[model samples]
Target: MCDYTQREYSCGHFRWIASKWCREYTLTHKRCQPNVTHFEYRADEPCGECKPKEYPPWENLIRRNKQATY
Candidate 1:
């Protein structure tokens, strides 16, 4: 079995990173398959997909034409 590192984000999302390769080889190209075992690690920040997006300050500006009277 291969070894991997699992990262847990604050947003409750997780990701796996391969750390070692297994002795088993693929049937097609004969390459080592790293697909088993994992070690857990905690992260203080949220994942990229879960983070809030920031918009430019100019986007919130309101423009008014002097000729237009309400």
Candidate 2:
């Protein structure tokens, strides 16, 4: 059954940095501090932020992926 829900995302900036051992990601930020990782990035990088957005459908997307993989 299709539930009456929607998917949305907060207007936030995100960045993924790759390392030899693991990958790092950012969801939000508090200041203008530059996020660093093992991979090289410019020093003029800005942190991410979040704004009002939908949520329910996005959760379902994650769940669906997990179920399919498992």
Candidate 3:
């Protein structure tokens, strides 16, 4: 069985992060094998993928310039 760690987000979402692999799988695999297991440890924070990304100041300026030209 594959082992995973549980991550809890402030947005009320849970994500499973891979921790260990069994004999049948390696790092290159995209998905866990069947009969996965989770570690008792948990993390509490906002999920990086679910959080909104902020644009840099220069990027905002470029967008405004393009809009003005239209």
lDDT of 2 at 31: 28
Name the weakest run of 10 consecutive residues (lDDT summed) in model 2.
1-10
**Cα TM-score per model:** 0.46, 0.16, 0.57
Q: What is each predicted model's overall lDDT from 0 to 1?
A: 0.69, 0.35, 0.63
Clashes of each: 0, 0, 0
Local error of candidate 2 at 10, Å? 22
Flag the better candidate by TM-score, 1 or 2: 1
Best by lDDT: 1
For 1-70, candidate 1 gives per-residue lDDT tens digits of: 5667777888889887777655563334454544647656566788879889987798669675769877
Candidate 2 scores a C-alpha RMSD against the true structure in Å of 17.7
Error of 3 at 16 (Å): 0.5
Best by TM-score: 3
**Candidate 1, which segments miss by more than 4 Å at Cα?**
25-40, 53-70
Candidate 2 C-alpha lDDT tens digits along 1-70? 1112222223334445322222222323222323343333334444444433557756866634435553
Off by over 4 Å in 3: 27-44, 63-70
Q: After superposition, how far is residue 1 of candidate 3 from its true place, in Å?
A: 0.6
| Candidate 2 residue spans exceeding 4 A from truth | 1-38, 50-70
Q: Which ten residues in a row have the lowest lDDT in candidate 1?
A: 25-34
